[model samples]
Target: MHGRQQPAGHRFRRSLTAAAAAGALLLTAAPALAGDGGGRGGGAGGGWVDRQLSRMSLEEKVGQLFVTYAYGETADTTDPDDVARNRQWLGVDNGREAVEEYHLGGVVYFAWSDNLREPRQVAGLSNGLQEAALDGDGARVPLLISTDQEHGVVSRLGPPATQFPGNMALGASGRAADARKAARIAGRELRAVGVNQNYAPVADVNVNPANPVIGVRSFSGDPHLAAELTAAQVEGYQSGRAGVAATAKHFPGHGDTDVDSHTDLPVIHHTLEEWREIDAPPFREAVRADVGAIMTAHIQFPELDPTGAPATLSEPIMTGLLREELGYDGVVVTDSLSMAGVRETYPDAEVPVRALRAGVDLLLMPPDLPTAYDAVLDAVTTGELTEERIDRSVRRVLELKHDQGIVARPFADVDEVAERVGPPRHLTAAQRISDRTTTLVKNDDGLLPLADDGGSVLVTGWGASTTARLAERIDARAGSATAHWAGGDPTPEAVDRAVAAAEGHDAVVVTTSGAATAPGQARLVRALLATGKPVVTVAVGRPYDIAHYPQATTHLATYSYGAVALESATRVLFGEVAPRGTLPVMIPTADDPGEPLYPFGHGLGYRR
Candidate 1:
C-alpha cells in the first residue's frame, strides 16, 4: 500500500496520462505560450485549489492530518446478549462523534471488526462513517478509509477474499511475479470496500531471524530481493486498474529488531552509514518507485536521534532523513500512536504535536482523539506548529485523494466492489502461484511420493491440520489413506503415538509448526526419525525450522501454512507442481558448526 501517498509508478502513469490528454487537447486548440500572462483558465484552476484550502477552518485542516481508529459507538454499547457483540471487538466502533466533532481527516479499520465479512457490508459501513465525517456539511472532505490487507496472516476481508502466502513465503518462492500477483489480488480486495489505502507490502527485510513482529511478513533477508518484491507489490497495488493505493511500510526498516514495537520500543544500534547501506535500501527503492506514503516505524535509532525518541517524534528521522536525504515528497504517516513504543514514552498530548513538528502528515490512532486534536490545535495557535505545515500535509493528503479518484468519485456501488474482490480469476491466480511456489528442501532416502498402498499415516505439529489437508490430497492421488492428527509439542510421546498409528503403514509424516527454534519440535523430529520409519517432515513455516529435523528422510519447506501454501505443498508431495521454490534464506545448523543447513535457492527436483 502506498503510505501517506500514492504509489510512485501510479503517479508516473497518471502524469503520462495527463500529459497525453493535454497534448490531445492542444491539438484541438492552439496551445498558449508559456509565461503569456496568467490566463483566465490557469487562474481559475489555481483559485479553485487555493479556495478549497483557504475555506477550510484551522480545525478542519488540522483534523485532515489526524487519522484515528474507528471503533463504532454501538460496538462499545452493544449488549452482552447481542449477537453482534463478538463482532464489535474487531475495532469497528462508532467514532463518528470524534470524526464529526474534531473534523478528523480519516479513520483506519482494523481487521478484527465483526462487520467486514462481505464487501457490501464493508461498503455500507464505510459510507456511513464517511458520511458522518462530512457531518452533513459539504465543506468537510470525505474521510480517508484505510486498512492493512496485506494477505495471509494480515487479511481484513475474510471468506470471499482469497488469502495468499505472506512475504516470507513469497521470498521462499523466489518469484517477483508471485509478489506482484499477490499485490494485485490484495489491491482488488481493498478497493472493493471503499478502502483506498493499504498499510502493506511490509518493506522490512527479515535479516534478523529473531524479529518477533516482522518474521513471516518480510519478503526476504536479501535486500535486493526485498527491493524487487517491494517494487512489484507497489506496482501491483496501484496498477490503478484496481483503484487502490498500496503503502510500503515500517519505514526505514522493522525487520532487524527482536522487540515488538506494539509492546515496547525497539532500538536500532546501526550507524547512519550502515543503515544507508543495508536497512534503507528497500525504503529507498519504494521511494524511487514513488510510493504514496511511508509509514514511520516506532524504532529509536540513537545514532540518528540521540534523544531516544521514536522515529514518529524525531525530526531528523522524519524530515532530515526521509524528506531531505531520501527526497520523499510524499506523505509521512506515523505507525499507530497507541503502540507502547510511543505511548509509553511521551505525554498523551505531546506525542501528536511532536509528530506534526517532525513533519508527520498523519497522526495515527492517538490514544485519546480529543486530546490529540486539542494539542495539535493549540500547537498551531502557539506558533509551535505553523499553519503552513498543516497546509502542506493537507495539500498532499488532498492530492492523494484526487489522484486515487477518491475525491472526484466519492462512493462506488457495493455490488461492484464485491464482484471485483476475490474474484474467481484472482483466486485461481493465487492457487497457481502457490502450486508452483511450494518448495521441497530435502528428499534423502527417496522417502517422498509415498506409495498409495501405504496404510496408516501419523500427522502431528503446530499446523498439522493444514499440513494434514495437503497430505490427504496427496494420499488421495496415491491410494486410500488413513491419517491421525495430534497438536502441540511434537514430543517423544507425540511421535510415539504417531509411530504406533503408522505401524501398519508405509511412511509417517511429521509436520512442525511455529519456527524451528521451538525445542519440543526438535525432540519430536529426532524421536520420529529414530523410529526407523521413512520420515517425511514438512515445515509449514520458515526454512530455519528444518534444522531441527536434518536426519528426516524427506523434508519440505512450504514457508507458510496459509491455505494457498498448504495446497501448494499437496501438489509438491503428489509430484503435481514442479517444486521449483528454493530456500530464500540460509537455514542455520543445529550443531552451530557455522555451515548453513540449507543454502539460499536450495531445492530438490523429483528427477534429480
Candidate 2:
C-alpha cells in the first residue's frame, strides 16, 4: 500500500550494470573507514552518544526526529507519476538539497524513488545522499534510509533481486522456520542495496474476510499462528548475518477491518480483552524477541483510546500501551503520515507536533516537511513541546543508527550488492517455498493430476501474460496447450470471444484474480463453465477467488502471482510437483457466515 506505481521518466545519471558495479565497489573500498567503520561514532567510554547529543543545537536536534520522503522522481520533476493531485505530495525534489536544506534525519524510498534497474543504482543513490547528510557541520549522524520492501506485491526493490513468496504463502506452508529464512534472505538482499530498515513481516491477524488491504499480507486468521510466524520473521530479518533492522507493523493490528486506512480511517470496536486475545499477541511476541522497530497504524481503536484517535497519534496506545505495558523500547515509526487516513484530517502544519505530543518517536513522511518542521519548532518556542521531549526522541533515533552501525559504514559496495542480491541458493529456496505453497482446494472427478497424454489444452482469462505463461509451463511438462485472455473484469464481447475460442480444447485452465470483490471475474469463470470442459481454475491472488465459481473441476490458490509461485503452480498442474500447501485462510462461497466452504488447514495432494 505504500507505493502505487513507478515513475517511468528516465534519470540523466549513468546507467549502472553488474560490470560497472564491480569497479564501483573497488573504488569505494579505499574509503571504507570514513564511509562505514573507520571513525568512532562513540568512543570506548560508551558515553559517546551522550557526548554527541551534548554538542547538538536545538534546530539540529529537533531535525533528528523527522524523516521525510525523497521520491527521486527524475533529477528534476514535480511529480513523474503524472497524477494531478500528487503534485503536492512530492517532497525533496533533490535528495542532496533535502539533506542540506532541512537537516533531516532519514528518507523513505518508493518505487518511483528507486526506479532502479539494478542494485548498483540504489547503492549510488544511497551513498550520494549520505555524503550530503554528512556534509560539513551537517547532522554528522548518517541518514536512516528506509523502504517498504515487504516482498510479495509490495516490493520496492525486487526486480534484479530475489522475489520470495509473501507471509500468507509461508503461513500456508505451516513452517515458522521457513518464514524466518524468507525474511533472512530479504534482509540480506536489502542490506546489500544499502537499505537498513525494512517495514515488513506484517504482524496482523486477518480475521475479517472483507479486509481489502491485508488479505495475503497477514500470516493467518488465528492469533497463535500469526504470533509464531511474526516472531520468527522478526528474528530472521534482524539476524546479525542479515544486519538490517526489521519493523513489525500496523500496531495493534490492521486485520478484521473493512476499510483501508490508506484512504480513510477504520474503526476497531473490539474490547481491551479482545485486543489482548486476538490482536496483541504477535506484537507482544515480536517485542519479546527484541524486534528492531514497531510501526503504528492509522486505524482507530475505540476501546484502546476513547478519544477516537489513531494509534499513530494516541498517547494511550503508543506510549501507555506499547511502551509501558508491553515494555517495547525500540523505535516506533508511523505508517506513512502522508496516507489519506491521517492527512485528510490534519491537513495543516500541526500534525507533526500533535504526533510528538502523543509520544511518537519518528514521524515518517510528514505531509509537508517544511510546514511540519516549523510547526514543531513553534511548539517548542511556545512551551507546548519541551526540549527534553525532543532530546529523548533525538537520542533514541541516534542510538538506533549507532546500533545499526550506520554512523560508520553508511555506504554499500555495488559489487557485493550485485553478487549477493539474488544468489543461486536463494532462488532455489524461493522455488522450493513456491512449490510447497501450491494449495489445491478441490479436485472434482479426481482431476488431481492432468493426463500426461492429454490433447490440446485451453488456458485463458485474467490477461494474456498470465494464461500464456501457465500454458507454456504446463505444455513444457505435459502436452501442447493454447491460451485465451480476458484481461480481468471482461466486457461482454471479451466473454463471448472466450466462449467461441474454447471449441476444440480437451481441458480448460482458467486463472482469475479479484474473484472476491469483482463479480465480473466470477461471471467470466461461469461463462467458461458453460463450455462443459474440465475447467481447472486457479485463484492467483486471494484464497477467496474460488468462492464465486465453485462449479470448476479444480480450485487452487497460490496467494500471489510472483514468478516463482506461478511457476510452482504450473508444476503442480501437471503433477511435476505435488501440491503441499494448506489454506492460510478460509474461503466463503455461500451467503451465510456460519462456516467457510474450505476451512483453514485444509488442502489436498496427489499421491501419484
Candidate 3:
C-alpha cells in the first residue's frame, strides 16, 4: 500500500514443480548473481533475480521477507534437548523441520536460544540450516544468518570470540580508525561462523544522560563524532574480505529517550528541523557509506508523522523520509516484532502486514511466525497488499543475498572456523582498543600509577566476574590484590565488608556500573573515601557516575565492564598504559544540572 505499485502481472507466479528442480542445481549451476545495486530491477543481478522471481510461488516470495529466530545447533539434530527447544519455540522437531514448515527465508542466532555455542558448532549449524532452506520443499534460497555480535555487553558467542569495549569506548578514544579495526575484526569472526549479517554499529547519538538502553552502546553524545565513527564502522564491517552485511540500527535515533522500547513504545518529541540537526547525521553518513541495511526504531516522532505511529509502521518515516528524501535504496528492516514497542498498536498478525505496507523489507522475529506469515499471504490474497508489492521486497532481499555472496557460498568450513575466529592477533587488537578507551577523567589527587611497588590493592565492583577479573589483572602487575563483588546497589553489610577490606589494602579501586541511578554504589565510594587511603573510582559502565561522585577526586571511565576493558583499566592504573581516552559524554555536575564535572573531551595522560 505504501510503495510504488507495479502492474499486477509484471511477473506471473509459476508453480513450484520446475522451480524445485532448478533449486536442486542452484548451488552448482545457477548463475552467479553477485554484485551491487540492490534496488528495484536489481542492479547487476537484475536478470538473474527477474528469472528467479518468475518461477516462485506467492507463498515462497512472502517467506523471503521474514528473518525469524530458532533454537538449535543443527537443523536435523536428534538430541532430545535440541528437539524440545525447537518444539517449544517453533513447533517443530528441529531447525530443518522449522525451515520446511514455515518456508523461512532466514534465521537469527542468539546464545540463549542455543543457536551459538562455539565457532565450529555455529558453522555446522549454519550449514545445516542452509541445507534445509535450499531443499526442494523449502524456500530454496540461501538463508541470511544473522546475529548481534556487538561485542561489549551484547556479545552472544563468548570466549573464543575476540572481545572489545563497545562503541562508546571507540567514541571516547576519538579515533575512527579504532572503530574501523574493531568492526573489521568482528566482521571477520562473524563471517567465519557463517553469519552473513551483523545487526550492529548502533548509530544512535546519546545526547541524554539518563538514557537506559542505548547508553554505552551509542558511539558518542556529539553528532559529528558519532557520524564519523558510524561511517567508519560500516566500511569496516562490509570490507571486501569480511563481506558481512552491516546494519545501521534504530533509525531516526533511539538516543534521547529515557524509556526502553523493549518494554513499551517510546515517543521522541523532536521536530523535523531538530531531527535533521541531531539524529539524522549518523544515518545520513551510514547511507553515504553504502551501508547494507538500515533498521527502523520502534519509537514515534509525532512531528514526522502526525498520525502518531512508530517508525516501524509509519510510511512517512520509512518510505517518504528514508527512501525518497534520503535516497537509500538498500534494505530496510524492522526492529524485532516480538518487542512490546511495535505490538502495542496492532495485533500479533497485523504487525508484519503493517510493517510491510509501511515499506519494511524484512520483518525480524515476529512473535508467531505462522500467524504473521499467513497474515501476510492473506493480505496479498485479499488485495490488501498486491503481489507486485511483495515482489519489490523479495527482489531487494535476493539482491542483497547475491551482493553479499551468501547465495553463491553460504557455508563455512567447520575446520577453518577455529583458525579464523578469536586468534591471538585479533585478541591483541581488541586489547589495544580497550587500552585506548580507558579515560582518566579526574586525577587531581595524583594517587594513580601507585609506584608499582608490590603494594596491595583492593578491586571491588558490581558483577562477581568483572571484579574477580580486575583483581587478577591488578595482582599480576601490583604486589597483591583483594576482590569483593559488592552486588549492584550493595547492601550496608556488603559496603561495610568492602570498606573494612579496603583498610588492609594500600589503595582501593571501586568500579561502579550505572552509578548515576544506583545510589548504593555512590554510598560505597563515599564510605571508601572516608577510610583516608587513596580511593580511585572507576566507572566501568556509564561515564555519568562521575556526576554522582563529585567528591571522589581520582576517577576513571572505562565505558565497559568487558574483560578486555577491565584489563586495560588495570594497565592504566599501574602506568602500563596511558589513559588516552577523552570523555565522549559530558558528566554533568552533581550540584548544578547544567554544569559539567568533566566536560566533553576531558582526560589525563600518565606523563610517563
Which segments of model 2 are wrong by more than 4 Å? Answer: 1-46, 73-93
- State the C-alpha lDDT per candidate: 0.70, 0.75, 0.82
Q: Over the full model, what C-alpha lDDT does candidate 1 score relative to the true structure?
A: 0.70
Winner by lDDT between candidate 3 and candidate 2: 3
lDDT per residue, candidate 2, 366-459, as tens digits? 7777788888889999998888878777766777777776776787787788688888998988888778888988886788688788577888
TM-score of 1: 0.86
**Candidates ranked, most accurate by lDDT first:** 3, 2, 1
Which structure among the candidates has the greatest lDDT?
Answer: 3
Q: Arrange candidates, best TM-score first.
A: 3, 2, 1
Stretches of candidate 3 above 4 Å error?
A: 1-41, 137-139, 591-593
Q: Which regions in candidate 1 have their CA more than 4 angstroms from the true location? A: 1-49, 72-95, 451-455, 480-485, 491-495, 590-595
- At residue 598, what lDDT does model 2 achieve? 73
Q: In candidate 3, where is summed lDDT lowest over 10 consecutive residues? A: 1-10
- Top candidate when judged by TM-score against the true structure: 3
Compared with the true structure, what per-residue lDDT tens digits does model 1 show for residues 182-238? 887787777777787888879987766567788778877677777888988888887
